[model samples]
Target: MTRTARPRHYLMCRPTHFEVSYAINPWMDPSKPVDTDLAVAQWERLHALYGELGHRVDLIDPLPGLPDMVYAANGATVVDGKVLGARFRNAERAAEGPAYLDWFRDQGFTTRDPEHVNEGEGDLLLTAGHVLAGRGFRSVTAGHAEAQEFFGRPVVGLELVDPRFYHLDTALSVLDADRDEIMYYPAAFSPGSRAVLARLFPDALLVDEADAEVFGLNAVSDGLHVILPEAATGLAARLRERGFQPIGMDLSELLKGGGSVKCCTLEIRAAA
Candidate 1:
């Protein structure tokens, strides 16, 4: 299929207060210091790149002491003018859940406060008229059910086995929603989930461990163009071979916080 670039709207938060104050995930280490300035620079460059591509970019105010707020993708899952609020499992990021809900509500979105634990886009990804939900690490299976009911969409619950790829976005990325094209790391998912992926996306690109470690699957794609981590050389080469214009950006500073390009981006889609 011939691919064309389309303008997308994304929401992001500046890493003004981004830091590893506490260890909620395996990648975070409070013992080691993070370069906040470098993180901001990288984030700004990404923001500019989005603008350069003629994409709409929105921002949310970053509050103090909320270091992980920079990862705006975990805020809420917005679809068809409705938002299913995130129910963070850890207390450290619990406050962020409500903050995002409030923002969505104020923006005229019909918001549903979650009753179960879910990490917004971190665990729930929309593609091919279905929601691929993650569980086992942060989001619960019950949360997947809740999302299914709220979104009025079929939700495929995929269990994450590896702690390194705790979130679904970290393990898989939707390249072409219309074509049901995806890229994923098989080892990150359980045997059953891998089977489900195989059934749903038979032609999905299987990323190797080297690219997966660099968070290559944690990418944002608009069918023809893919923005990914600069270190993911293998993934970049594969994307090119597949006719995707791969744009690499350095988010090494933010990687310390266990987030990359896609981690900092939240796609805003209107109701179908």
Candidate 2:
């Protein structure tokens, strides 16, 4: 009999104000909103979908000032049975860690906190042999070493150059398990990071900045399922042709904060 692994559960935050950051290039049209009511409806729809897909979904009250909190993946990490709520490097997002801790405690989760001031979850990437922690952007190299010591797993440090792709999820994601194939954006990864990635998965698919911008090279979930934006239709079609189920959503509001599907959804627990 084939064994089916249990699906991971997560918490998703709703956006309080759907406005884009003016300093960032991609701006959501402030003049026209599809419908504030529809936005609420879509959030509920996603909530329902995750539940239907056999995932435990927790809904958190939206924080007014932190609009990007909906991308929960950036704020937390899960290893084994423990959930680590990250301490965001951005002052605006630091509040999210305590909120996550409270949420997890209420849900009966045993959680861990980063040892240092730097604890953004997006910096940590789970690989077969070890976890690759991006040193630049929101998470620090010290935090990576701490994670290694705590988990007893090797940790590789990486430096991120672009602020837009501040987190590793913005430019890279693990796909196949056995082969360890990764989909990564070339520009966002450092030379050392690339070298480590190549050694782990020699045939890793290198995606471009444009594709990553459109969320085309983010995460591939459950081997066959992928969570990406509607903008990646071509990539979606290719994935479908390869017998993969591509789930697309219109994350227009998330673009304001430079995050997407992978950013907002934190998988707290997954079976090995």
Candidate 3:
């Protein structure tokens, strides 16, 4: 089957305040130097790339103290215009939850404040058949029930075992939601979750440890085009072999905070 590109609407936050002042994840280190200007420059290129690809990009104002707010994908999960807001597990990012939800509410989207802790799109990913919810790290399993009820879609709970791939978005990328196609790292998930994924997507693209380390699975796709980190050369080739145009980007600066293409870009799947 031939791949096709569809223009998508995205929500992004400029890396104006991007930094890794604290270590919440293994990738982050307080002692490591972060060049704020470089992060913003790289992020600007990403924002421009979306426009060049004919995708609409809308930006959320970055809050001064919220450095991680640049990873807007962690803000909220929007499906069919209904918004399920985030509730961060760590206090470092706790305020980000409400800030992102307020943006959705301000935009006139239907909003629901979550009952349990789930890091928005970080733990919840939408596929054609179901919503893949992540657990065992950042988001709680109970939050899966909340997402299932709100989206009116079957929520398949997957357990993340790796600290580096703490969030679901870090370990998996839904390549084509219409086809329920995905690309993921098997090791980041538990054995049962791996089995679940295999059963659900037998033809899904699997990534190696090298690609997973560079946050290759952290990607954004528009059916035909898969935008991922440039470092994942192997994954890019695999995406091409599977009939998708892979656009490689250098988001190495953002990697210090454990985010990449998908983390910085939040898909706004509005109701048709």
Best by lDDT: 3
> What overall lDDT goes with each candidate model?
0.93, 0.66, 0.94
Instruction: Pick out the ten consecutive residues of candidate 2 with the lowest summed lDDT.
Output: 20-29
Superposed by TM-score, candidate 1 places the C-alpha of residue 80 at a distance from the truth, in angstroms, of 1.3
How big is the RMSD of model 2? Answer: 3.5
Q: Which stretches in model 2 have alpha-carbon errors above 4 Å?
A: 1-6, 17-42, 177-179, 270-272
Error of 3 at 185 (Å): 0.6
Per-residue lDDT tens digits of candidate 2, residues 176-267?
Answer: 54345567776787787778777876776667666677877655365656767778777677666656677887765555456667666776
Model 1: per-residue Cα lDDT at residue 96: 93
Worst 10 residues of 3 by lDDT: 15-24
Q: For residues 1-272, what per-residue lDDT tens digits would candidate 1 score against the true structure?
A: 57788889899999999999888788888899899999999999999999998899999999898899999999999887789999999999999989888888888889999999999999899997699999989999999999999989999999999999999999999999878899999999999999999999999999999999999988999888999999999999999999899999999999888899999999988876
Candidate 3: C-alpha lDDT: 0.94
Please provide TM-scores, in order, for all candidate models, with all chains considered together.
0.98, 0.83, 0.99
What's the CA error at residue 242 for candidate 3, in Å?
Answer: 0.9
Candidate 3 vs. true structure, TM-score: 0.99
Name the better of 2 and 3 by TM-score.
3
Backbone clashes in candidate 1 total 1
